[model samples]
Target: MLKIRNLVGGYTNTPIINGVDFEISKGEFFVLLGPNGSGKSTIFKLITGQLPCQKGEISINDKSLSSFSKLEKAKKVAVLSQEVQISFDYTVEEIISLGRFPHQKGLFKTLSVEDKEVIEEVMEITKVKQYRDTQFRMISGGEKQRVLLAKVLAQQPEVLLLDEPTNHLDIKHTFQMLDLLKEWQQTKGLTIFAILHDLNVAALYADRIALLHKGSFLDVGDVDTLRKESQLETVYEVKVNAQSHPTVPKPQLLMTPNHSKTKSELLNFDTSFSITKNDQFIHVQFESPLRTISNGVIGEGIQWLKHFCNFHVEKHYNGSNPKQDLQKWMEKYEIPFEQSVAMMTAVRLEDVVIVTKQIEDIKVIAVVTAGTGNAVDITNSSLSQSHEKVGTINSMVFIDAHFTDGALVNGFMSATEAKVKALHDLNVKDPETNTMATSTSTDALLLAVTQQGKETQYAGSGTVVGKVIGQTVYEATHKAVQKYFHRLQK
Candidate 1:
C-alpha cells in the first residue's frame, strides 16, 4: 500500500502539483487521468524520487520513501516509463537480466539460479520468449514494449508504476498488456498506479480513478461516478456523449465533434421512401441510414440501416434455420447485408399497406403487411400448439426526427399496441384457440429514426410523436388486414 500526505512538488520553485493527497490500497489498480499539462507525469516523477519534493511525505507500508536506499527501492518498486532510450544494442535476455541487480550477491552481481528462473518466468508471462536472443532495438514497437515489460517484471517488485505503457502498442497488444497486468494484480496481489490517456481502457481495467486538472484533483471515485459527460467535457474541453456498453456493465464516453449545419440543410435532410415489390420480395429503400431497433430475422437489435426488406415465403415454409436462409437469400440478391434489416412474411406482397403522414415539422411513415392465419393470443398461447410458419405481421415505423434510446423503445411499444388495437377492432382471431389474438407467433416490428430534427425525450402514447406513430400504424395495419381478408374471400 502507498499513501501521500499533502503532496506538493514540481520542477522549479513553481509547483505543478499542489496539495494533492490520496491513498492506494494494496493490490488496487489506480489510474491517473488528465490533459497534457495536468501534472500527471510530474506527480509520477515526484513519487519515484526523480524530482525532489518541495513539501509533504510519501510512504509505502508505513516506511518513508526518503528512508529507502537505492537498492532497497529497486527491490520494492518498479517503473516502466512511456519510452526508454537505449544507445547500446542490448540483447533482450541481457536487458531482462539487469533487473536482478538488486537481488544479486557479492561484487560480481552475477545471475543466480533464482534470478534465471525469474527472468524466464517474466519472459513467458510477457510473451517475449521467442525474441529473447534478438537485439532489443531490432524489434517492433509493440514487441519492444513487451520486452521492456519483461525486463521490469524480472525485478519481481511488490508495486508497479506504468506511464502510458500501451501508448505505442496497437489494439491487440494493448489488450494483451492490460490483461497481463490485471492477472498479475489478481493472482500476485501486485499494486498498480498508472497514468493512462484512454478513458475507455481505464474504465475497463482500473479499480479506481483520479481526475486531475490544473494542479488539483477534480474528482476521485469509481468509473460510474467519475466518467460523466459534463465532467469530461469540462476537463477535456470537448463535447462528449456517455452511454453504457452493450455487452458490459461499464460506461463508455463518445466524443462529439463541433460541426456547423445550416437551417436549410437540416430542413432538406432527405428521408424519402422508395418501395419496389415483386413476387419474391418487397424492398424499401431510404435516402440515408436511420438509427433502428428491431427484432427481425436479420439485422436484429440496434443498427443503422438504409434498406428494409420483407421476403415472401410459402404458407408452409418451415426452415430449420430461417436466419441463415434469409442471409443466403440476401447474398444471392447482392444486397449489402451489413446495411439492411429484413424479415420473412407468409402474406402476399401485393396486399402490403404504406402510409406517410406529416405533422408540422415532424413526419412519420408506417409500413405493414398483415394476416391472421398464424395469430396467437399471447395471454393464453401456452395452451396452443406450436406453429412453425413465417410471421404474419411485419411492421416498420420510420420517423423524421431525433430520438433517445428510451424514446425509441417507447415508440416500438406504442406501435405494437396500435397494431393489437387494429386487430381487435377488425375482430381477427387465432384459428386454433378461436380467442382474440394479440399478435402473430413471430411478429416482427422495426422502429427507425432519421435523428436529424428536434430531440424528443419520450415517445409514449401520450407524447406528440407517439400519437403520430400510433395513428399511422393503426391506419396502415387496419387497411392491410382488410386487404388480406378481401383476398381470401376471392
Candidate 2:
C-alpha cells in the first residue's frame, strides 16, 4: 500500500507535481497517465528519491518514505525506470541475480538455494530463461526490456514501480509482457505504480488511472470515470473521442481531425443518389448526432454512428439485369459478392494515421463484424477476396434513388467496439461471473452506408436480415434526398 499527501516535486526551483494526492491499496495496479511534459515521470522521480522531494510527503505501508533507509526501501520497493543503460555486458542470469542483492549481506555473499529459485522463477515468468546465459547487449531493445523486467521481478519486493515499461514493445510483445506483470500481481499481490504513455494499454492493465496535464493532476480515479471524451478533450486541449474497452473498464483514445496534418484532406460518401461529406474540415461545428447508419459500406459496431446519415431508399432494380456483367466484375476484382467477413475500427478524422501518395479525394466507409465462433471453417474461405481491394471496404460510397449500388464493400469497427465496450464502460469487476445471461443471436451483424448516391447506392447487401436494417434508414433518407434534389431542380 502507498499514499501521498500534497506531493510536490520538479527540476530546479520550478514545481511540476503540485499538490498531488492519491493512494494505492495493496495489490492494486495503479497507473499515472498524461501527455509529455505533464510531470508523470517527475512524480516517479520524487517518490523514488532520484530527485529531492520539494514538498509534501510519500509513504509506503504507513511508513514515511523519508524514514525508510535506502536498503530498507530497496527491500520493500523495486523500481524499473525507463532508462537502464548498462555499462557491462553481463549475462541475463547475472543481471537478474542482481535484484537479490538487497537480501544478501555484506560483500562476497554466496548464492542461497532460495535465491537461485527466485532467479529461475523470475526468468520463467519474464520468458527470458532461454537467454539466461546470453549477454544482455546482444538481444534486441525489446528483449533487453524483458530482461530488465525479469531482474526487477527477481527482486521480489512488496511494491513495484515501472516507468513506461512497454514503450519499446510492439503490439504482440506488449501484451505478452503485460500478461507476465499481471500474473505476478495476482499471484504475489505485488502492487504496481507505473507511468504509461499509451492510454489504451494503460486501460487494458491498470486497475486505476491518474490523468495529468500541463504539469498538474487533471484528475485521478478509476479509468471508467476519467475515460469520457469530454474530460479527455479538456485536458488535451483538442478534439478527441474516447471509448471504453468493451470488456475492460479502461478507456481508449481517438484524437479528432488532424488539423495539424493538412486542411485539404476530405472524406465523402456516395450513395448513388447524392454525395455528402463525412466531415467538413477547417472550422467549428456541432458534434454529430447520436446515431447514423452506413450502407454497411464502412462501419464498426457501435461504430462511429456519425457516418450513418439519412436512411435507406428503394433501389428501382431497373431489371437492367447486369447479372452476368456484375458476376464477371466481382470475380475479376476478387470481391465477395455474398457473405464476407471483415473488421472495422473508427476514430475521429484526426486519430487516423493516414498513408497516401496521390491523396485521391474520395469517401471512406468502414464495415465491421464481431462474432465468437468455435466452428472451424477457416480453410475453405477464399484468401484472395477483399472488399477494399475490390474498391469496397472502407471506401467512399455513392448513394442513389430507386436504385442502390449495393456494391460498396466494407467492414464494421466502431459499433463492434461499442457493443463489446458496453461491459467495459460499466467498469465493474467480475462482469462475467454473473451466471445468468440472455442473448439469442450467435451471428455477427454488419452495418453499412452509401455516401454519394440515392438509389442503388443506398440499397444494402448481405442476408435479408442485413437489408432489413436499412429499411428505416433508407426510408427517411429517401424522403430527405428527394425533397432536396427536387428543390434543386426548381
Candidate 3:
C-alpha cells in the first residue's frame, strides 16, 4: 500500500507537484493520466526519493518514506522508468542479477539459490530467457524495455512503479507486457502504479485512475467516471467523443479532428446513388462511405460501407453457410466484401422498390424487396417453423446527414414500424396462423448515414429525420409488396 498526503515537490525551489493527495491500495492497478509536463513524473520522482518532498508526507505500509534507507526502500519499491542507462556492456542475465543486491547478505554478496530461481523466473515471465546471455545493449528497443522490466521483477519488490511502460513496444508486445503485469498483479498480489498516455488501454486495465492537470489532481475515480468527453476535453485540451466499446463494458475515447468543408460540400445533400441491376442481384453504390448499422448477411452491425446489395435467391435456397456463399458471390463480382452490406431475399431483384424523400436539408432514401412466402406473426409463430433461411423482406434506409448513436438506433426502429404498418395495410397474412403477419421469419434491415451535414441528436417517429425515414420506407415497402403479389397473380 502507498499513500501520499498533501504531497508537494519539484526539481528546483519552485514546486511542480503542488500539494496533491491520493492512495494506491495493495494489488490495485492504479494508473496516473495527464498531458505532458503535468507533474506526473515529478510525483513519481518524489515517491521514489529521486526528488525531495517539500511539503507533506508519503508513506508505504504506514511507514514514512523518509524512514526507509536506500537498500530498505529498494526492497519495498522498484521503478521501471522510461529510460535506463548503463555504462558497462552487461549481459542480460547480469542486468537482472543486480536487482538481487538489496536482498544479498555477507560482504561477498553472492547470488543465493533463491536469488537464481527468482532471476530465472523473472526472465522466463518477461520472455527474455533467450537473450539472457546476450549483451543488453544489442537487443532492440522494445526488447530492452522487456529486459529492464525483468530486472525490476527480479527485485521481488512489494510495490512496482512504471513510467510509460509500453512506450517502446509495438501493438502486439504492448498487450503482452500488460497481460503479464495483470497476471502478476493478481497472482502475486503485487501493487502497481503506472503513468500511461493511452486512455483506452488504461480504461481496459486500470482498476482506478487519477487525472493530473496543471500540478494538481483534477479527479480520482473509476474509468467510467473519468472517461467522460467533457472531463477529457478539458484536461487534454482537445475534442473527443466517448463511446462504449463494441465488445466490452468500457468507454473508449475517439479524437475528432477539425475538418473544414466547402460551402458546396456542405449544401450538396442531393448526391445520387448508382443502381446496377441484374437477374442475380441489385447493387447500389453510394458516392462515399456511410456510417451504417445493419443485420445483413455480410458487413453486419456497425460499419462504414459504400456498396449495398440485394442478392436474389430461389425460394428453396437453403445454403448451410449463406454468409460464406455471399462472400464468394461478392468476390466473383469484384466487390470489396469488407466495404459492402449484402442481404438475400427470395423476391425478384427487378421488382425491388426504391424511394427518396428530402425534408429541408436532410435527405432519406429507402430500398426494399418483399415476398410473403414465409411470413410470420412474430408473437404467434410456430416453433417448428422458426428455423428458416433469410427473410423475404429486406429493407435499407440511407440518410444524408450526421447521426448520433441514439439517432441511428431510433431511425432503425422507425423504419421497422413503418414496414409493419405497410404490411398491415396490405392485409398480408401468415398462412399457418391465418393471422396478419407482423414480419418475415428473419427480416434484415440496414440504417446508414452520410455522417456529414447537420448533426441529428434523435430520430424517433416524431423527429424530422425519423418522419422522412418512416414515409420513405412505408412507401417503398408498400410498392414492393404490391409487385410481389402482382407477380404471384400472373
Candidate 4:
C-alpha cells in the first residue's frame, strides 16, 4: 500500500537516498536493514515528509504523499521514531490519548467512548496497562518503548512505520512487541514498514527484507534472499555465519569478531594426547579446543571443546540417565562444561585403538573402541525390543587440516560412512537378524580437526581430506573390532 519510486533525498545538497525504488504490499511486514549511516533512517524521514524529497515520487494507494494534509496523513500513517524523549513528565494514559487528536472534532475535544476503548485495548495489547497511570519517565526504557508503541497503536492507522522499535526492550519485551505487531498485521491487515538492526528479528518477523547500503538498495527480496552469508558479509563488511533457528526455518546470523581465535591457534602441539586418569573416569584433554562434530549423548552436534572424557563406573553402578550422571560427575570434578565434551562408554581404556597417518604434509589420527555385546541391525525384518545393554562403538577422527563449516559437517558424515564400511568388511553379524550389522545399538562418532595447513573446502568422499579420513577410520575401526572379537573368542 506504500510505494516509493526513484526516491532521492537528504539533509543537504548531498542525497542520502539515491535512486531507491521499492514497494510495500498491503498487509506485508517489510523491513529495511543496513549498518550505521546506510540511509535507513533517511529513507524513513523521506517517506514521512519530515525531510524534503529531492527527487522521485512516493505514493500511498495511488495518492501522492505530498497530496495528503497533515491530519489526513496522520490518519493513514503512524510513525515511531528512534529518539523518544518527552519534555514534560506525562502520564502513560495521557501520552496514549494524544494519538486520538487526529480523529478529534475540535480543540477542546472530549474523549469519546470509541477513543477510550481504543486506548485501553492498545495498552492491554502492548502489555503497558499495568503502568497506565504511572508517569512515563518513571518506568524503565523498555516499558516506555511499549507505552509509545501503545500510543502508535492508539492512532489506529492503516500503515505503521517503526524505527528500531525493539531498541530498549529486553528479550521478553522484544518478542512481545514483535508478536503484537505480527498479530496486528495478520488480523487487522495493518501494513508495517520497519527499520531493524537485528538480522534474526528481521528474519523471523519480516515477510520481505530490503538491504540498504551506501544510500541505495543492495538487495531486496524474501528472508532467504537476504540471508546469504556472503551477501551479509559484503553488505555489513563483517564476518557472519548464517544458521537455522533451533525450532524454526528462519535463518540467524552469528557475528564473528575479527580478533576471535580458534582452538588450533591457542593450543600447543607438544604431545599428541593429553590424558588424565582418575579412579572413576578417564579424561582426554586436547592442547587446544578442537572443532568437533558428533552424535554422542553428551555434547552432540558441531561445537568447539577442549576435552573429551569417558566416564567409568563400577559394574553395579546403575544410572537411569547417563547424561545427567555424566553432568554431575563433570560438576564434581569442576570441569568446565563449556570447554569439555564427554561420553559414556563401558569399554576399558586399554582396548581403545589409536592410529595415525601422514599425508600431504598433514597428520590424520583415528581412535576407536568397539563392543558387539548388544549389536542390532536396523535393516532386520524382526525388531528386537531388548534393552539389556547399551553397546557402544565410539570412534573419533582428528586431522591437522583446516576446513570450512560445510566440510566439518561433510567430514562427520564421511567418517560415519567409513565406519559402517569397516563393519561390513569385518563380517560382523547381528545374531538376531543374521545380516551384516551396519552399526552397534549405541554408536557415536566424532570428527575433530586442528584447522591447520591447506583449507579443505568440502570433505566428501572424493576430497583428499575425506580420503585420508576414510582410509584411517576404516583401518583403525577394523583393528578395534578385531581386538573386541578376539576378546570374545577368549
The TM-score leader among the candidates is: 3
- For residues 8-87, what per-residue lDDT tens digits would candidate 3 score against the true structure? 88988999999899999999999999999999999988888788899989889999979999999999999998886678
* Model 1, total clashes: 0
Ordering by TM-score: 3, 1, 4, 2
Per-residue C-alpha lDDT of model 4 across residues 1-490, encoded as one tens digit per residue: 8999999999999898999999999999999999999999999999888899999999999899899999999999999876779889999999999998889887788889999999999988888898978998899888888888988899999999999999998888889999999999999999999999899889999999999989999899999865678888988899988888888888888998898556655444437567676546667678777888877668788888777766655434457888888888899988766676677666655677878887676678887777766576777866673435535688877777888889998888788888889989888878787788888776778888776656778998998878888889888888888888887678
Model 3 C-alpha lDDT versus the unseen true structure: 0.89
Best by lDDT: 3
lDDT of 4 at 285: 73
In the predicted model 1, the residue pairs found to clash are: none
Displacement of residue 388 (Cα, Å) in model 3 is: 6.3
Model 4 global lDDT (CA atoms, 0 to 1): 0.83
lDDT (Cα atoms) of all candidates against the true structure? 0.88, 0.56, 0.89, 0.83
| Candidate 2 lDDT by residue in tens digits, 187-263 | 98999999987777887888899888876777777877455778787776768766666876557777767544132
RMSD of 4: 2.7
- Model 1 Cα lDDT, one tens digit per residue, 1-490: 8999899999899999999999999999999999999999999999988899999899999899889999999999999988866778999899898888889999888899999999999999889999989998888888888888988888888889999999889989999999999999999999999999899999889999999999889999988854578988888998988878888888788888888556655534343667788878888888778899999888898788989988998888889999888889888887776888999988889888988887777788888998877788887736554555434899988898899888999999999999999999999877677889899887889998988867888998998888899999999999998998888899
Ordered by lDDT, highest first, the candidates read 3, 1, 4, 2
lDDT of 1: 0.88
Error of 2 at 340 (Å): 7.0
